[model samples]
Target: MENPIINVKNVSFRYERENVLENIDLSIPKGSFLGLVGPNGSGKSTLLKLILGLLKPQKGRIELFGMPISKFREWDRIGFVSQKANSFNTGFPATVYEVVASGLTKKIGLFHFMDKKMKEDVISAIHSVGMDPFIHRNIGELSGGQQQRVFIARAIVSKPEILILDEPTVGVDVKNVQAFYEMLDKLNKQLGITLILVTHDIGTVTNKVTHVACLNKFLHFHGDKEEYEKLEEKDLSSFYQFDVKVLSHEHN
Candidate 1:
């Protein structure tokens, strides 16, 4: 078996004298599409931040790519799109190509020109998200769904091993959400990128992910999709402290 790409052992976090997460343990292997579902204030975002090395846990440990997060300096291996991504200023005034290329600025450095290979990489990333035609268009002119794709293109431009998105479909139109997920499925299966999605669309996401993690200050359940599907809706509702539903569907 392959080593876990992300490992969390007995992790705990607190904020303003309140515990957000308690004794959480999780392991994610390569090529896994893990969906994190929970109600408001369940610490789902907190956990993602911890794994991304943005916040330190008060107790226990976290490892990324087989190395302790504290010691993991190869940040390019992970790509993150936060919940606020949908709120980005549509009037930011930048072309899709320029926005995608900006993802490499950290590696390319400031005051440096983009060479031929770098430009080619940017184009390839745009194409991967099916945004090649919009490459020369201003980002502000694109629709919400198109803009989200641009953000995803930016995230994957570096060829990261993992992609983490928090509520990526929040503001997207309902009709476009399915297409967005299909694009993600391609990125996962075709590009071989591990995915960790934090979403509230539990009913819809369950059918698309390989694994499901139910969280509410602590891990209520973590298992394969088949096992998750076997669980009763009432049980899931009980864990969430409210009524919950898991809709079933066929994946294309």
Candidate 2:
């Protein structure tokens, strides 16, 4: 078996006196599409933050690409799309090309003009997300789904090995959500980018992801989709700390 791209061992965290996560262990291998499902306030987002090095765990360790997060400095190796990215100011004045090109600002440094290769990379990223047609459009003028795709292009502009998303389809219309997921699937399979998605749409994500991790201040379940699908309602309910049902649905 290949080594894990992301590893969390005996991780625990808290906010003041409240314990948010306790003794969490998870391993995500290369090319794995992992879905993180849990109820609200279940510490799903917190765990993502921990893995992203945005927050420090009170106890235990986390590794990204086999390097300890605390010592890891190669941030360009990972891409992140937050839940609030699609909610950018409607009047923000930036073109899609400009937005996607911003992903290289850190590497390019201040006041440095985009060279020919950088411009090609920008266009390539937009094409990867199927937003080439809107490459020149104003980012603020696009629909929520379109804007989300542009942000995804921005995230992948650097060609990161791992992509972490938190509730990426929140503001997107139902009609476009499936397409958004399809694009993500393409990125994972064709591009070979590892995916870690934190979402509440278990019914929808279960069909798309290769692995599932159930979280609620603790690691309740961690396994492949087949085993997750075989779980009983009672087991799921216990994991979520409430009554829940796993519905069967077909993916488009």
Candidate 3:
């Protein structure tokens, strides 16, 4: 891309005796919905952590908006959505509005009441995710798919320019997966948010994401969807056995 929003150059990371990522170079252009796919333990989460500034790479450099990650202090410009089911308590006693409103904690600071404008932003975010009807409903009472959208609203309520989602659909129903992705497409196309999605739903994402990056410790491929789609299906099925995670989740 001419001027990427996020850039990684020759980045290598490891844990204890194992190397997770090696000499990886990747860039995310503004307004691009890039899907990051690879096998489990191929450092997908590690790479995300590096980009989120949760962990630093042992070698090479990473930049956010052309600024070195170490010096890039505009964290509010980015939003992150993690696999919620693993951590969120289904019985948490909070309404959807209350849950989404909490996203402003860092931006609005602690113990301060939200201004009317902030409340409007929260409601608008919920509307954008098509969850405004359930604004006052209990979070735990909602289905997995509904909860997922609420969390996304929470992430975008702050009006972040970039959204990074790591397996955000793990608990969603099979039937609702496409709808989830459609909402993501809306966020990218309508809201103009840059998205870096680490996903295994290649069969669906290929139709939505602008770019695709195949990772297996080493980046096997990084290109536009059309270029990736042009590869023979048989070739992918045969050559990418090393990355079973991608092949296993190609469900349409």
Alpha carbon lDDT at 51, candidate 2: 94
TM-score head-to-head 2 vs 3, winner: 2
Give the range where candidate 3 is weakest over 10 consecutive residues by summed lDDT.
Answer: 242-251
Model 3 C-alpha lDDT per residue in residues 1-252, reported as the tens digit of each score: 688999999999999989999999999999999999876787899999999999999999999999999999999999999999556788999999999999999989898899999999999999999997899999998988899899999999999999999998888998878788889999999999999999877676686899999888888889999888876665455435542332323345
Q: Runs in model 3 with CA error above 4 Å?
A: 242-252
Return the lDDT, model 3, position 121. Answer: 95
Alpha-carbon deviation at 54 in model 3, angstroms = 0.9
Residue-pair clashes, model 3: 0
What tens digits encode model 1's per-residue C-alpha lDDT throughout 105-195?
9989988989999899999999998998899999988887888889899999989999999899877888878878888989999999999
**Residue 213's lDDT in candidate 2:** 97
RMSD in order of candidates: 1.5, 1.3, 2.4
Per-residue lDDT of model 2, residues 1-252, tens digit only: 367999999999999999999999999999999999999999998999899899999999998888899999999999999875456898999999999999999889978998999899999999989998998899988988888888889999989999999899988998877788889999999999999998888777777799999999999999999999899989989999899877644553
Candidate 2's C-alpha lDDT?
Answer: 0.90
* Candidate 1, superposed: residue stretches over 4 Å from native: 248-252
TM-scores for all candidates: the values are 0.96, 0.96, 0.94
Q: Model 1 residue 26 lDDT?
A: 93
